[model samples]
Target: MPALTAPAKRLHAAWLASHAEWGPGLHEDGFGLLPEDDVESPAGFEAWLERLAADSARCTYRWITEGELVLGGIALRHEGNNSVDRAGHIGYGIRPSARGRGLGTWALGQMVEEARRDGMDRVLLVCAVGNFASAATIERQGGVRERCRNSGADKVWRYWISLGQPAEGD
Candidate 1:
């Protein structure tokens, strides 16, 4: 079974294999990777992990894994940051090969519970307008469509999931 695990150096080799499948760039979303994040070197990867640890007060990151395979990642951004306003409270992505397996939905459900445990009554999730898979995942978690807004060149759909209520279609 796949589970959400904290980012760790022990999974470096598995992470690299997954990253290779993602090709290049920091578009992995939930990994919280930045342009300066040098994950290629052991030292740099350790530093990057430290940075994520330091930012834990503001956000939480987790990898969706089954055994040693790094399947994908998910992140929950706590309130009080401008990013929460613009990017929403949660962001996630599954590896291309891992898509269509319901991992995103399962991970999202777990993250929603985490948000509730953290005292958030609700959470906002946004995805590109045409990302049906992501939209469906959020909807399965009881995400209600709030609006669609233009962000850069893409129109993104914003959704809100209330932690106080049971998920829709449950």
Candidate 2:
């Protein structure tokens, strides 16, 4: 909602470009239209970008710390629309190319900060039980796993992050 004030322009552009390639994975929005990259030929991906750029319902954005066009993560606030499935208070992928560098952990921390900023005393995060990477990401962000269960073919792990007290392991 605010203009980029510094070295954030690159991160903004990179973030948009990555989102342009979004596939069938869960998004912050409950409903997903195909990404430009997935819906069209390579030649048409650019056109798809044009369309996505024109829509306001895509995703609310943020300006990360200055001097990094390549961001650590993109964070979304849960409108509770996608909370039942793919969308939650937090949803992130480390740009595929950005994986294994602890960006997910960093992003989760940022989401926690956003949750605190939004005045939520606690937040719920769910991940497929076998999604060990995601589960670890949440744990590193101070989430305490409450339980795990089956969700269709996927096992889901549920956790709670308490903003009312010092973070776990801190």
Candidate 3:
């Protein structure tokens, strides 16, 4: 895993090639792996990467790669504001061909470790009710469900994972 920096341009391109539907959950100028618009030109891609590197206030996007092959991406938000309310602190995805190999679990564990390193003793994770795989991954990482609620068209499960000593709300 590595931070999305200038050198990760090739990795970004590879990810975009394999994960075409990545734009759906991504926000404009947010810390996701990609943006809503298609980066057609090389210059446009570079510009997007530059903007991603520059945006540190929102969240941090990390590429989960092995060698030069980009497998997936994970994000850790800096605050619990905005869409973070339902999305929670971390969001991640694996490439189509890379699923079912336990990479998602590993990446999520890494994100939790990253959160602990960043001083977040406990972190919240919310997953869509229909996404049973994600919920299982979170549970495998010791996440305990706090509640469930209907959000928009889907029901979401809110979970809390203690990174260190139990926090006030944990």
Candidate 4:
């Protein structure tokens, strides 16, 4: 394991400061682990975080932070999309402050590496049809928009990222 270097630490600080909405997270584990310690109940978010922290089937990590602010994060679902189409197994979100900077694409890109490291056949990502940013990000990541369908009321676009395969980066 590698310790968080100074540059990475700087990015984390920028991230936290940028997303003060999640201010308390900065104090958790001192690296934005979502310190929900204030909550005593073991059935709500506190429990959820605890479970999330302990789970091995899935992992959530900050791809990069622009300070304490989270530029975005990457989550890996070990189940690897149970649906027939191999829906994406990763989820991500860029801090509002970091939006429009291509961070989502970069975040997701790093997630692909994470998926490979976690041993996956591929990743399937679903994006809202109207979310041009997501669409753009997916495209840049070599996500072939397989199809679009209605999910209750909103339209969704499905993308595929083959595992054990070199991504656009490789």
The number of the candidate with the highest TM-score is 1
Q: What is the C-alpha lDDT profile of model 2 across 78-122, one tens digit per residue?
A: 445453344455555555555586766765676677667666787
lDDT of 3 by residue, 25-144 (tens): 553112354545446567766776677677656777777777676677777876654757777888777776777888878988888987887888787888878788888989999999
**Candidate of highest lDDT:** 1
* lDDT value for model 4: 0.58
- Please give the CA lDDT of all the candidate structures: 0.92, 0.55, 0.71, 0.58
lDDT of 4 by residue, 104-137 (tens): 7776777777778766777778877787888888
- Comparing 3 with 4 on TM-score, the higher-scoring candidate is 3
List the candidate 3 regions with Cα displacement exceeding 4 Å. 1-7, 21-36, 165-170
lDDT of 1: 0.92
Candidate ordering by lDDT (highest first): 1, 3, 4, 2
Off by over 4 Å in 1: 165-170
Per-prediction TM-score to the true structure, in the order listed: 0.94, 0.59, 0.80, 0.64
- Give the number of colliding residue pairs in candidate 2: 2
- Per-residue error for 74 in candidate 3, Å, reads 0.4
